[model samples]
Target: MQNRQNQIEPEWTIIKILQWTTSYFKTNGIDSPRSTAEILLAHTLGFKRIDLYLRHDQPLNVGERNLFKSLIRRRISKEPVAYIVGSKEFWSLELVVSKDVLIPRPETECLVEEALLVLDKDKVSAPKRILELGTGSGAIILAMATQNPDQQYFASDISINALAVALNNARHLGLDEKIDLFCGSWVSPLKENNNLFDIIISNPPYIRRGDIKTLQPEINRFEPINALDGGEDGLACIKHIIKNAHKFLNKSGTLLLEIGYDQKKAVDEIIKETGRYAQASFRKDYSGFDRVVCAKKAYD
Candidate 1:
């Protein structure tokens, strides 16, 4: 390996480097080994991910190779790739993220999916009022607003740092003006807000307190605890939103939330307990897990 490094025309090319990194990552127990290698290499080279294939035979200089080695070291230590790169792609829109916010996951996209379904079905007028609770990184609301530009949207978070990342992303996508952002927990900022929304959506923290310790290192270590802890049974945040959502929804307005797969029965009971929602149902993600719960307000 040392001799190959010093060759004037090094034998280590893009394809060769990727092969080595892929095997190395696999040995270290990283999932999607090949893809992880490609993503990190592309970031290190400042090239588009697909560009990697186009330049398969390209050789890196000593400095570039060293940078990739550094990135690999970070990954080996279990640092999340998104945080390493400082952004992640969600709903096909790349959003900035950091330790302050949960990295957007594919399952959360289902929240956006169900929201669009409700919007299209209602065919409500443009500027349909929508609010998202616990809007970490603004993933759900921004994706919804981007696709439905006519909607009036608002999102709130208690952590200023997370909100800052979300704000930057909104500005980057030129959708900043579309969302009214607030710095407060749950419904605090919406006080005195009578029947204000046509739809309320959130992917709030629902991971059980005990279960969090069993999560992947990527989650348990890198992600923020406040954003993951659901208190005792992981329903603390969910229950609060369900109870207050009725007060903020117009007649027949909707409250959509994402919850743990197994929490369906528990959350269902919470919705029923309020008796404020007319219809409560769940939507499965691409993986066929009960990932999102939808509740329609009962007329006052």
Candidate 2:
């Protein structure tokens, strides 16, 4: 029991804490043990991961040690590091996150990549206008604006809390001036405006209600249900977006959406039935899953 007591002690150094946290996470079935340990420790120390290595042997003081222990305990309970650190890196930007918004997933980057491709193909002029629906952390829209500085962007979410988080991220990334934001259900906030976008992108909620229970505890338990629960079959929001998107999209605008692996056929069918889109196609993510669907509105 003495060994157990030592493991829980707060006096551990930077290196020792790293070793302990990694082993603890691994024993608890966390797949990315070492990386998780490094991120959590770096966050607690207010230093970058590389700085942590440079100060490997340095001891953490009482305050720092206590904070590290608190974060370690939360991790052991299966809390996501993004929640613990209150930020996540997406598209090379560290964006703030919380229970109010879904943690940005790496796969969602494909949405941005797909958007850039569509924009390039169309050869949109400078200051092209873009709209993003369900902009949880504002990661997708903000990343695009950051890359295409001349692009004007707008982001909207159904959750007011989510819009707040997205707004904060916009401010932190210095993209606030370039991006307009709104709150309310999809299309509601923009209905009165006649502004047509060159591209519309989204990472809407896609998990089926029944499947939520099967997700990892860090997600199903801690993440907001409204951000993950996609009505009965997970296609509710996607269907709504597809039906109304044409009204907001310019004649030649593109719609880029992130979908679940099994959702490709259903979403594809929806796009086909709409009859307002052309060249609708799916792009696989890094994991080889059919993840992003791109469709362009007919020029007519």
Candidate 3:
């Protein structure tokens, strides 16, 4: 039996490898083992995930086995598959990503949806200036700008590397001309210019500093800490953005933000306490967690 098993191991096929790797992933505490198995295997083989099933009986070449093995080990080590593949899909668009930026998550799309909802009220097609701070990889602004190309867009990040990745993605999507990129913290980019925007959107870091170490290993260890930590209360960035957003908004301009589920009440209170906003509201994500905050500046 031992000799037969040893002799047959060299003939592993796509389906065989997938079954073996799926079990391996489960044993290592990885979630969605089968789905992850397919994604990593397909990525290593340069095949679409569905295509992997099509050629299930095809034997892996020596190179393919070596590469797939490396990816499997990385997954076992808790690296996010999106980083391993080097791109992620947001708003139905594929954007390049690296360790320099946070992988755009599906929940952030709610922020985009809310922004578009507000923009729909605009009767004319005139360009409306919009700005996204902490624009990691330019996901939010790029996705919004792509959908509303006529709008003047600007994106900024404090991290040079993050800004570089965002710029690369902007150029990749042919959005460079439409989005004015900058490197600054929060609203400082146009502070001197006295710039005002019709819409301001952000998904700034909202994770509590101490709680970061308690998050999943893939997130706490792999993603950028600066993009995750929001200080002792987890409202540091949110508070700053809220406090300053009104100063940069046009009359009755809108400000939309993606926030942590637990932060809805706290953020809503902050918005109300400010006394600059007309009224603030919250939107829930698919899981029924309060995921976004929508507010408008008072028309003076």
Which candidate would rank higher by TM-score, 2 or 3? 3
TM-score for each of the candidates: 0.95, 0.93, 0.95
Ranking of models by lDDT = 3, 1, 2
Q: Runs in model 1 with CA error above 4 Å?
A: 1-9
**What RMSD does each model have against the real structure?**
1.9, 3.2, 2.4
Model 1 lDDT tens row, 129-226: 99998888999999998899988999999999989989999999999999988889998778645538999999888888999999999889899999
lDDT of 1 at 288: 91
* Residue 184 accuracy (lDDT) in model 1: 91
TM-score of 2: 0.93
Clashes of each: 0, 0, 0
Candidate 2: give the clashing pairs: none
Model 1: pairs clashing at backbone N, Cα or C within 3 Å = none
Leading candidate by TM-score: 1
Off by over 4 Å in 3: 1-10
How does candidate 1 fare on TM-score?
0.95
Compose the digit string of candidate 3's lDDT tens values, residues 73-151: 8999999999998999999889999999999999999999999988988866778999999999999999888898989
Candidate 3 versus the native: TM-score? 0.95
